[model samples]
Target: MEDFKELTKAEEQIMKELWEMERGFVKEIIDRLPKPKPAYNTVSTIVRILETKGFVTHESFGKSHQYSPKISKEEYKKGLTGKLLTNYFDNSPKSMLSYFLEENRLDVRELDEILSIIERNK
Candidate 1:
């Protein structure tokens, strides 16, 4: 598997659109964005940056390019989670889970559901 470089906020936004559409032109991506929308050139530039970073690829249709994500959302999320676990939790899953439980004030049912998931995974 290729190591994914972290995306800038703008790049991530563009990526989300590509992931949703599977593939699209710049106008299609911009149309899906929330208001206030970014400029067309701004999105175009970010998509190009994502291509350079190996996260996106484009198909050419005459003068137009349709972009798609090379990396899946789950893959990106896993990489980001690993980085967060290492940097903020000292690579300790226990510490991370403890922090989440303490900070979020999750109900007993939520905790039970989490435990069930852990048990199933194990």
Candidate 2:
């Protein structure tokens, strides 16, 4: 597995935007943000931090830079899941499933779907 550091809230927010847009300039990212959005420099700095963290890359177009995600959303999700499972679930899928089943309300349909997946995998 590739080594990775957990991203800060600000960095994750910017990554979500980059994942959705695929690629964008700093100003474009700021424009896509909701009302009471962060300043351009704030987003710009986060993007640079992401680049340093190996989550993003950029292409320089004269004075402006267009940034893109180096990792896919699914890959990031999988990484987080692995960390969660190892750190909290004793690296046991059964323990993780039991925790969810006990702590959350799972509809019959959802249970059936999970059972179907288990059956198919088996």
Candidate 3:
């Protein structure tokens, strides 16, 4: 997959809704949002921007368009994690794990679970 453009906060919010719904019109997306929902035109504009960024595509039904995510959530997660690893940890998995361990304060059971996952993966 090609590198994806980083989504703005609003774009990410809209994309999350699209990912959940699989597809939706702008009003449908807004309806799913938390209270104090954005204006219809604002959501519509951001969805169009998402399309231009190649993260979403629309199927037109006469005057209305239903949008769907072009990039899966998993795909975006991988891309974002890669960027984070490279930028903050010098592309080092060990460094990333060390940071996560120190910052998250995992309990012994959680740490053991993580070790088990590593062992299984190995």
Candidate 4:
């Protein structure tokens, strides 16, 4: 989770592509993007930053470098969630759960399952 660090919006977008592809060269990433793709150098620079941040790694395929994620998407999200809980929710999972239950309408079945889990845990 510490490996996730944090990514800028641009970096997140690039990471999303890498996560989707599982692995890709710079050209593959650039090609799969939307109609108005970023410049090659721009993507290259960002990927380098991601590598430096420990979010990505590369393997040289002769002239080109193929990039892949160092952290899985799930692990990244877990790191982000842990930070969010500590920063915004006062490090209280109970408080966060209460906030979620209050803010959203939970279906009866879902509520029952959640209650059951709580009861079991207790």
Best candidate, lDDT-wise? 3
lDDT of 2 by residue, 69-104 (tens): 999999999898888898899999999888888988
The list of candidate 2 runs beyond 4 A from truth reads none
Candidate 1 to truth, TM: 0.91
Give the least accurate 10-residue stretch of model 1, judged by summed lDDT.
1-10
TM-score versus the correct structure, for each prediction: 0.91, 0.91, 0.92, 0.80
lDDT of 2 at 42: 88
Of the pair 1 and 3, which is ahead by TM-score? Answer: 3
Q: Which has the higher lDDT value, candidate number 3 or candidate number 4?
A: 3
Model-by-model lDDT, in order? 0.89, 0.90, 0.91, 0.90
lDDT of 3 at 86: 83
Pairs with backbone N, CA or C atoms under 3 Å apart (clashes), candidate 1: none
| Predicted structure with the largest TM-score when compared to the true one | 3
Query: Residue 64 of candidate 4: its Cα lDDT?
Result: 88
How does residue 60 of candidate 4 score in lDDT?
94
